[model samples]
Target: MTLALVEPTVDLYGAWWEAHEEWGPGLHEDGFGLAAGDEVDSPAGFTAWVERVKAEDSTCRWIVEDGQVQGGIALRHQLNEATGHIGYGVRPSARGRGLATWALGEMLNEARALGIGRVLLVCVADNEGSLRTIERNGGVLEGIRGDARRYWIELPAAGESGVLTEKGADG
Candidate 1:
């Protein structure tokens, strides 16, 4: 299947909402940058949210496959100890196709383009899919804090090989 990471736009509203509804009611969708007060159900509110998340500090992209919204991924320009520098998620119906892995690899490329040498990614310890996705992209286990598993991924510099290794997987 062909997958494209594109900017969030109103044109995909229906498709996005279908994926959003499948995820049900929760802020855990990740990468869409949903806020507590934002009303994504309405056109005006979604429009506002789209504008807000596209700010200079962050980059958000929707994962579109075969003209449908499958998931989303975001790269934060500034690193936060709690949330890390990148976040992403694939819709429930679209799982198991390696979409998250592909999106993450693309986001890592974006991070490298921005001069970020390394990034921290955290996921629940029980989330095997997310854990594997991160690891496939070179994420090294830093430690487990409570229910969160923190990892650090070091990006290869320009002209270096992009192949990810399991060098620090035991960490």
Candidate 2:
């Protein structure tokens, strides 16, 4: 089904949200519904959210396993210094499977494909798992924001460092 239909249809995004709502709105962020219809109720509200969020060079996707949502990833284009803001989360049941790490890699490839040269990924310091995942992906420590730690993952470019070579080589 098309993405537009998913949010408004109970059969598609509804079931996924029912199962994973505990992840919080901050997880799926969807690039849409950030301001309008944060609670995704009415079909009209969902449609409005979609229309208002048609920003250029940005995207979000859910990771599915056995037809169920396991995680989600998103990139906010040029959130800062020409770097995309990368964010992701794996469902509670999907934890410990390295799915977040894998998902981040996929999002990185998506960013590179869009000509993104770097991404800033921030997570809570208490999230040891996330810190590990970012480090494994060549994310360099940037700074700390309250309880969050910021990292910059460099993608391969004509003159930039090849920190993301692992994926860029094949991406």
Candidate 3:
């Protein structure tokens, strides 16, 4: 079970779209609707979104596996001057492979080095795997906002030990 995380490129986006079309829809019943008629769905929106995220602060798009994309994860930084948080996510087929845990661990380490103080991850109430990923990364459940469960992992204050050391069971 070897895997690597690569940045999201145009080619990666295409692979993700194909995988989503094949295995994403109905995986969770009516949770995430599949792209209808090849219209503007989550993947398409995500492709454009990642580009926009790249324009600001920094955007990380990762492809899992030696050559297969599997899925992508990203850290979209918040730029509110007072808040330097990062938001992230992984693709469907790539979910249960610990890719999220690895990507997140890498992101947190990178964030710490970049002077970031915290990372935030949010998921729907029913997204158990995502919730577990965040928790394994030392994310503190910070209550819910509407339908989303917000979690936070405060980077070790300067000179403190980093919290996330072990990957989750899924990985």
Output the number of the lDDT-best candidate.
1
**Stretch of 10 with least lDDT, candidate 2:** 1-10
Query: Cα lDDT for residue 98, model 2?
Result: 78
The models' CA-based lDDT, in order, is: 0.91, 0.64, 0.61
Clashing pairs in 3: 6-63, 8-61, 98-171
Q: lDDT rank, highest first?
A: 1, 2, 3
Q: For residues 39-96, what per-residue lDDT tens digits would candidate 3 score against the true structure?
A: 3256667666445545655656554575666544555455432222544445555568
Greater-TM-score candidate between 1 and 2: 1
TM-score-sorted candidate list, best first: 1, 2, 3
Candidate 2 per-residue lDDT, tens place, 1-171, comes to 212112222344555565457666453433222553344556655445444444445676666666666666667766753223876666677678877787788778878888888788888779898899899888999988778788988888656556344546875
Score every model by TM-score: 0.92, 0.70, 0.66
Global local distance difference test of model 2: 0.64
Off by over 4 Å in 3: 11-14, 23-53, 79-84, 157-159, 163-171
State in Å the error of residue 32, model 2: 8.0
**C-alpha lDDT of residue 141 in model 1:** 97
TM-score quality measure for candidate 1: 0.92
Candidate 1 vs candidate 3: the TM-score winner is 1
